[model samples]
Target: MPNDKGRRRRFGSVRKLPSGRFQARYRGPDGLMRTADNTFATQTDADRWLVKQEAKILDGDWTNPDVKIAFGDFAEDWFKDRDYAATTRERNAVVLNRFILPTFSDLPLREITTPQVRRWRTDLIEAGVGAASVAKAYQVLRAILHTAVDDGLIERNPCRIKGAGSVTHTERPFLSVPEVYRLADAVPPHCRALILLAAFCALRFGELAALQRHDIDLEAHTVSVRRAYAETRAEGLIVKAPKSAAGVRTVAFPASLAEELAHHLAEYADAGRTGLVFVGARGGVMRRNNFRRIWLRALAATGLGDVHFHDLRHTGNTLAATGGASTRELMHRMGHSSVRAALIYQHLVNGRDHVIADYVDGQIRKVKRPPHGPSGT
Candidate 1:
């Protein structure tokens, strides 16, 4: 043989480095020579590492050690690979740009450690970022890293901070029946029905904005939630499906609202059956910025003190619970996709139990009362 000393081995080779540590190199199945990402202190340890790489290749699980995709590039591709709603995409974009990508953009996916994620969250909170914003940012970061793990780009997710993605929901004040009527009376004449329906029917603002005359059945006192409106920065206001399958429901309203509905239809509503039931003063789509001014004024006039429009839905759910709506019934009425949310309203039913007990006592007295004639048995 002609100088076999300088030739490389068939599977792998180990050599003592000038630093006295051993390095391993192997010929990959891709026909390219590759080196271990780490150095070993002895030749035996280096041989063991190369043997593991050979085992990975033979088992069809070998991933390129040198695949150094940057986090921002992978995250962009991950976001694009999915078909998300316009609103969801917009929110994710905001979270990524404002919180996540700035910290981890240049770091390679495999190099992101759990310590770095914890530090990032701590920095955001220390910088006075709101808890909700931090939670959303953490959730998005965890999701992106989760996908990276699934793609075999990283061994484990670095987002191991327990419950960091979830935020505690602080209970907000809801309108009472009188408060609801007062707020309704305070708003503009055209929006009175909107307030009532939002409070009683538990309609979302988007659902109310997307309503057409045909969506309401005055005779049946039902509102069909077929579609909803979402304002995205990328596409302005767009009509899309409801947020969930449970949202695409037809909910019955109290027959008492019939007069209010009829009055709104006759006065300020668009003419045709297909025409919008509620519109801005310009007779176009209802934009939040345009409507919020009037809403705040009405809140001030009624002394509601900055009650969000969604609080009306909360009030409605509470009312339904007090009216003896079961968990399933509450879920259906509120279009809640999960029992967990419906259960929160169900907890509000505790105070109604006193009324239930009094009613039962009256029924028992009616049954146990003496005979009508002469106190006969």
Candidate 2:
């Protein structure tokens, strides 16, 4: 029998098989023994393969052959490990099943290439997937691959399509103060306070929907955002804590609406402190699907049909910005966890260009003219 330990290479060991083929094996980064996919025809071929693997290891790009996990298998584990909100989890699952799996389901995590990622993205756009959808799906895939890299399942993430993960959103419509009240009036009597609170308090629809009678303190002129509602197939109308730590804040409403709020509490609000602040016609939890009917009717009646209900929050944030709210203040008031969203809303402050121009003119005038005595000096 040939000395089965045929040769000792610099990086790993090569052994001659019973069938006269040479096999290469090495210890991987994960401290596990790994073997090449196929036996080499000769000892030189096995040594050459080991040399290449050693070079890759030195360059920090070697992947363990034992990590033959398929993309679908890794993705299943990835999804299970995610601790995102219910709605976010649902959205990710939908995107994975719809867009990602069809392209890379059976492919090994290590076999995914950057060129393949680029082509997949191109194919998605050509197949008429919306730009936003493509961006979202690309983000999901990139995130999964990044985790795979961190987990040492792959040498590197192959998601290198530049700007493929960004989506440009169209400018959203914002309502004027009068337009907010007009829409509020157009909605049903019970829903008027809901609309006004959404606009003035700068509250998200879920936050408003999750409100309870005790969360509002008319005397304090503040509303406490302790929780939010999310719609999910797994759990209908799941009530959960705020989206972020900053989301759990007490926001004040102007005292101008105190009367409206008190009246709403006495008339429309349910009896208990924990009772729903806003509810359906039958005094049940408010759902967007059911509320869309009322919302569409109010839109038609207000002649502001094109406006999205979420735009009310935009209008509120814009008003706050124009009122000279700082970046930090905007983040707090908007319950934003990042400065990005706060800055986006802050840019909507009208007349800022004129304000800047006037400021520059004032500086020039101050330099040109100095205060003088009555002698006109």
Candidate 3:
């Protein structure tokens, strides 16, 4: 039991107040005495708090409460530190301005709590935000808060909702080999090779759109993916390297495609080593929106409605799996850095176990029958 006397301590002091409470005061880095806002019921509580404050000061983690930065300001700085692609930067900016800033822009970084984060996420969902959109916004928020934690702006990240950043997508449609060819024939004559290459080579639309005449070696039967294009509202068309290091690989094509690709290049593709291989009717970049009508018409004609253009690549991967391609081979052919997408093809091929089972049944039948005589043979 401390009396009405005060005891001097290193960097601070603890005193028993006349109201029968213990008060703690410390000299801040600004050379001013900062007293605890409320009194502690026990002298031990007051001493513990003062010791913690001193430890923070000694460790250079003490932040001036009055000069704390706003969440928006810190987040802006965090974004500027990274060199993001144009499309990615535009997407992050949209989420920040549309979802994050409205809720916690003015709040100081230190003031945000886990409950506040949970409430904000709930509010966004209640306001009719799509699950995917909410997930994206939450991801951006978590990234910002994660950097805040690293910078010592806060002790912990408030974005702690498990699985809050993941968006669940419905199964994508898959196309059959005959369906792929039907759709290819239904499209315009100039785009026949484009559809074939997309389905057979598993090349993404961006990779196909950015292909140059020099990238394809008909003699070598390979296509080199050196660059890719991204269409963004702000930049219109931004050309960059492949999304991953593995994406910049040379993929092989069937000998049958060599003639078709040659014909397309000679007749339709722009002339020059750097000439665009797949362009619009008027020799412009093939924008998806501009060509959507043509694609839709082809789908309607082929009776393959609601199939996305990307499903061509999926179909190609499925065929590759059926052809006995290994996981590493699929990864290389599809230009994927991770095995996650490659594993999907593995799962798809599991359906072919019925063929193995049928082969086993045939073997069993052969054993059950009597040995064939020379005359029967």
Candidate 4:
């Protein structure tokens, strides 16, 4: 007998079945100690599993030995623990209810197989959902299954199965410098500064609309992006932290743009100390639909065709990258969390080879090749 307090206790025991396979037996979650039999290459392998189980129990994160819950019920439990924005929660709920739950809802998670998930994906494609949307639906399913695995409700995630078709990534459309200037000139006088900031500073539309007098420093020529405004189904407009830590940064503006911002502040920013820098005619947050209407009308006025408001931010990134800004500088200015995203903006600018060649030529002319040691003396 082993001391329960001082020594590691051995389970009910390993026994050889009639087929000559060794099986390890252990108590399960039902308060009834049960034995799980499996074939192991050696006794050492069985011992290793016992050690792992002990460690999991000591850490108080042990998963149940058996999984038996329906995936739909488990998903509800998983959703209860997640803290997400109202819109994000709604979007996830829609994906789960419409696409994911119907197939896997009543089935026990432990019984789900890769074949079933593949069939579900095939049905989604046949129903006219794009590959990208299907991929997103797959991601939602994967996340839910991952949570179930973590909680010991399942042994592995079936959604990890491969062979999903390539997901089409949407590229952001950007405007040329000339197009940017034309847009700036065509927008309503009151909205021109906002549009210019979006194109020149790479500010997101939400961040641009959330700007307050206190967030801009005219003397420093910088705008602090601390908050953003987003509309939710339940909440019309709500202010939230800039999406990530990188987003909560102070980005510098061109001196000329800073001057324009100063003038706009003086003319339109309300007498209230905390007034919004850009607002609706009724002194509320600017809505996306209204801004899109204004942008389309401005594009027509400028003789430009079919430009989305988001292109202004892309135009800003392209201008910075093409004007000899380093990747680090672009990342800082654009509030991008990864170098890859910064590179995408840099690649869109074009004509970098010519710029690099001119720089190399200038450097070569300045070098004096070791003072030309006289005729190889």
lDDT of 4 by residue, 69-160 (tens): 88889888887777876667777788889888888899988888888888999999999987877887898888888887787666688886
Instruction: Sort the predicted structures by TM-score, highest score first.
Output: 3, 1, 2, 4
Output the worst ten-in-a-row residue range by lDDT, candidate 2: 368-377
Query: Superposing every Cα of model 1 onto the true structure, what RMSD results?
Result: 9.6
TM-score winner between candidates 2 and 4: 2
Q: Of models 1 and 3, which has the larger lDDT?
A: 3
TM-scores for all candidates: the values are: 0.80, 0.77, 0.82, 0.73
Over 1-377, each residue of candidate 1 has an lDDT whose tens digit, in order, gives 21312236567987776777777889888889998888997677877888888898897777786789999999999989868889999998999998999999999998999999999999999999999999999999999999988887887899999989999988977777668877877888888889988887778999999999999998866788888999988999999998877777666676556677887888778989888999999899887778899999998888779689899988777766766766666676677766444443353355332333233223324434332121211
**Structure candidate 3, residue pairs in collision:** none
Please report, in order, the local distance difference test score of every candidate based on alpha carbons.
Answer: 0.79, 0.80, 0.80, 0.70
Q: How accurate is candidate 4 locally (lDDT)?
A: 0.70
Better of 2 and 4 by lDDT: 2
Q: Which runs of model 4 end up more than 4 angstroms from their true locations?
A: 1-67, 163-166, 338-377
* lDDT of candidate 2 over 202-311, digit per residue (tens): 89999998999999988867788889989998878889988887787766675556677787887788889899899988888888888999999998887895888889
